[model samples]
Target: MSKELEKQGWVKRTTIDEPRLSEIVSEYKSLGYEVHLEPVHLEDVDAQCKKCYENQSDKIKTVYVRKRKQA
Candidate 1:
């Protein structure tokens, strides 16, 4: 007999505020789903950069979410 393949799925999110993120994550948890947060940081940010590298190191913060374990 041949084996059957199972399908999988998940949710992805873009940059969001802390309170909203928490509310969404809590909802997912209540639904018995797994939540994953990915932090994205970039250097040499145009806005955050300083006059000289010695003065400051630029960085950008962003977040992504992934929800899994759905029926």
Candidate 2:
């Protein structure tokens, strides 16, 4: 997580496979959270999964969510 995001109260949720990203994002929004997505970097991948990610065309992303402030 970046310092800026943390300062703004964003919390790391989970890394989701590309196919399910939209579904999870919608779920978070429906529950009143603001969603942020960042691409999963090679360094962040586990040793066993690194090869899989590199060989596949699909992407993985880290999800961040922050509660919406009351108006």
Candidate 3:
């Protein structure tokens, strides 16, 4: 899915906590971008970072954004 998104021009932005997710999403939308969010996946994390997200994955999200195609 990540590869598919990248192929479609969606750039991975950041993985963030839910607390600031809405604010960031709104910012991207306001800037005319199409934003997509996915729950953090185990494979998405580095071995060292996996521990931190193992139990908190549900509280975090992976952010991807792409410019809206002009009609």
Q: Could you say which candidate leads in TM-score?
A: 3
Q: Which digits, one per residue and each the tens of the lDDT, describe model 2 over residues 13-67?
A: 9876766989999999999999999887667778987877676525777899999
Q: Write the per-residue lDDT of candidate 3 for residues 1-71, one digit (tens) a residue.
A: 47898899999898888669999999999999999998988896899888888889889899999998899
lDDT of each: 0.43, 0.84, 0.89
Q: How do these models rank on TM-score, best leading? A: 3, 2, 1
Q: In model 2, what are the clashing residue pairs, if there are any? A: none
Candidate 3 local lDDT, residue 44: 69
Which parts of model 3 have CA positions greater than 4 angstroms off?
Answer: none
